[model samples]
Target: MNNKTTISSFFWQIIKPYKWWYLVMIPGPFVTAAFVFGYNYAIKLLLDVLTQDKILHYGDFVYPVGIFLGSHFMVDIFFRISNYAEWKSQPQVRKDIMCKVYDYVMGHSYNFFQNNLSGSIISKIKSINDGYYYLFESIKHNLTAKFLISLLCAICLLCINSKIFIMVGLFTVGLVIVSMTLYRKLGVMQGEISNDYHGVIGLIADNITNIANVSLFASKKAESQSIINHQENISTPLRNKWFKLNFITEIIVTMIYSLFGISVLLYSIYLKNSGQITIGDIAFTMSMTFLFQDNIFGLFIEVKKFVNTWSDFKTSFSIMQIPQEKIDKTDATELKVSGGEVIFENINFGYENNNKVFTNLNLKIKAGQKIGIVGSSGAGKSTLVALLLKHFKADNGNMIIDNQSIYDVTSDSLRSQISLIPQDIVLFHRSVGENIGYAKKEANQAEIENAAKMASIHDFIETLPEKYNTLVGERGVKLSGGQRQRIAIARAILKNAPILILDEATSALDSETEQQIQKSISDMLETNKATVIAIAHRLSTIKHLDRIVVMENGAIAEDGMFDELLAKENSKFKALWDRQVNGMVL
Candidate 1:
């Protein structure tokens, strides 16, 4: 959408849900304007009463004083009520918008996340949240109240003298023109400033997340200098420019207000001295002019803030507007896994147009078959699993599980039937039990303990002071790589899906631990009659599988029983096995 459309829709989306609160708040600005107008009139009445030489009774003096006090009290009450209404509405509005934005971010496709920075997305979320309130405050309070007050002041001045009215009108026009011009300029600068700020945040987050790597590589000094350079060379300079512009705008606005106030005051005094108007008229004119001057200053500040916030709003909505790349079909159904049989037929897949990973590939596995896949780094090992799990849509293919096409099934259901133990295990900063139970959120402590035991990590967990309750730290940094891998295995065990995938699952474990876990996995598969697919670089990890498939450039180079492949000296599997055996001997 265009900027104008996006801005309008964003505002409406935030406020439309809580229509009642906004409806109540609609009159707040008008009431405030009325109070300002009434309070000035009250002052005029009081001045008139005090200046009158012929005070026949004390009631005249008391009446004007009482009116002034009463109006003051009423205005104060109205202000309080208006503030209370705003306080009640704003928190809920902010919370709802924040939640909605979070939901949108979470729903984004995997590719979207791969291309964006987590810290930058976080910055956008916060910016949108603050921007919404800023814009709302500007429109609901400053814009409405100031406009009404200015109009009332202009009318009052016209009644007193057309010359005064004409002067105020021209000043208003000039103020608006200047404010608009400044607002546009500031918005462009603010957008640049915001981008630089996001970059700084992103850099900090990236450095912190990889702090271990930096420390291991002894690059802390370099990283720190990089951050400092970003701050000094980009963020700091842009911020200075933004603030300077704002300061200049404020100075100009204040000067205009001062000039307007001076002109009105002189005109009012001249008219009073000529006996063309009373002291009351002079008092009223000066009071209104001073009030408007304050309002105009506040209005300009709000306008500037609104402009800056508009930039933030646009940045946030740009992310939200990204269409989901993977969406379920209208007639998608929940996948039913009867035998866990999987087949890939006539598959053509690629990351880019010129780089096809798999072209016209075909593969099939029978129910409860333990198949091992071995391939080079980019030979489509992980990509094969990803396609079966529907992480990415195939360029042209049919991936069928139990005679049901995966594309015709809901992604959640299609994935629920399969459990993957990824090579690079990433654990949340949570307790051991919590991480284990992630596969099944409703799993009880007993189930968690059982899964851990099966994965052969139960003994290690018992050694820690907090045991199952210990915090894993960010990405499971508190634990060893082997421990993290075991935790992931425990999670997959708890999942207990019909189809299981082991992508270098034992890569981090020591030889003894690997053997124990492999035995446990083998037993589990036998007991459950599960279909298994293991992708590994180490031939030892998959040498005992029921069937072995060696891939070369995304095509099946060799497919046979492990013994048969080993017997063939010319086979790719035999070549990989020879390399590993020779390396170990050396």
Candidate 2:
């Protein structure tokens, strides 16, 4: 949704929908500045009246006192209005940003997830939340109100006495120029720090995910040292560079504020001695100088914070700049599975760096066909499944389902018709029932139990303390490899999609369990009249299928019925069958 090229543009566009809330907030800063300046003006009048009694009207007492107190009341009233507006606007803006970021990030192709760390991506998302919070607050309070207050005081001094104005104005400009220049350099440094922090998080996440491996190898010390080395050699040095530059900026800023204050006081004494200005004017001038300095200090603090926030905001949210890898046609329609026939026509595809997996390949599966695909490593077996599922688009070809081009339909609709039970199944940390019910979001308990029964996992689940309600733990670590495989099978049966893909699905199960599950799956698909694609390294898994296709070197080397292919002399299927049979005997 973020077609905007610049971050500022994106920020403003997000805020634009709530423009009315912003309008109510904008006036608060201006009103606050006027009250502060008017309060100082009133104080001057009160001093003048008190010092020279009867020279000005004695009745001026009430007017000066009233103006001074009235300004305070205005300040209080305007603050409430601003606070209410902020309450309405801030959270909504953040909510919209988070939702937009999630939807857009999820649209990234399957490879995006495979290539990046889960923790690093999570950290960047959090950065957007904090960065925008700081940036927005700084703009409202410091950049707008405090800024107006500084300018008003400067002009007030110029109107009454030119000398004080020149001294304060020069110092203000010098500090601003120095700050802006330093911030540009500091912002880049902060971006580097952010990168280091993300890397550390990703490293920790990677280690945690491989905890089993580390414990098995007894390499905890090595892993700990690796993390320490990364933090000391990289993270610490970048942060230290930021701290040093911050100290230098602070030193320069202190010098300017100190010099400006000293000059103002010295000039005020000169004016009083020459009888050029009254005691009342001295009080007003000193008061204005102090107020102006405070506002400048406020401005400096905000700018420093803004620099750091900008660094985080841009670096983290830059993922928006990446165009989605897959998109549907503008007129894309929902996919309809009429008999579920799939045709791959003149398909050419490759992964990164022109690593060709398939070239001008073609295949066809009739409606409700039980097809078995067997191949060795890098023989385009899995790639074929990935392409058919539309996880990656073909380089030059059309994939049609039920006479409709997959490219011409929405991905969600296309994928809805297919159920995939991947080899390495990763389950959410939820109840056993919830994991199985994932296939159908609204599935009842009865349906889930039935699916589990079909997959032969229901009996095992019943022995657990909470039965189907038992927690799976992180990535289903609570369960054995065989148990996890059974859970995956249960989901596919529950989904009962028009098309089913089983990629080494029963590999973890024992010989008897695998055979039983395979029989159950064949019966289920045959009952539903669904098209099934089974890819397996185990030849026994596909021996019962109607037809077997043997793939080699990215092409179909042989295709026939199980026994028909074995009967052929020097057939590809016959050689594979003999090798597996011989290996089993050994």
- TM-score, each model? 0.94, 0.94
Give the per-residue lDDT of model 1 (tens digit) for 176-238: 999889889999998887777776787788888888999999999999998888789888888
How far off is residue 553 in model 2, in Å? 1.7
Tens digit of per-residue lDDT, candidate 2, span 166-187:
8887888899899889878899
Error of 2 at 295 (Å): 2.0
Clashes in model 1: which pairs?
none
Please give the lDDT score at residue 563 for candidate 2.
91
For residue 568, give model 2's deviation from the true position in Å.
3.8
Give the number of the best model, judged by TM-score.
1
Any runs in candidate 1 off by more than 4 Å, and if so which? Answer: 1-5, 79-84, 509-513
Q: Deviation in angstroms for 184 in model 2? A: 1.2
Model 1 scores a C-alpha lDDT of 0.83
* True-structure lDDT of candidate 2: 0.86
Report lDDT (Cα) of residue 361, candidate 2. Answer: 83
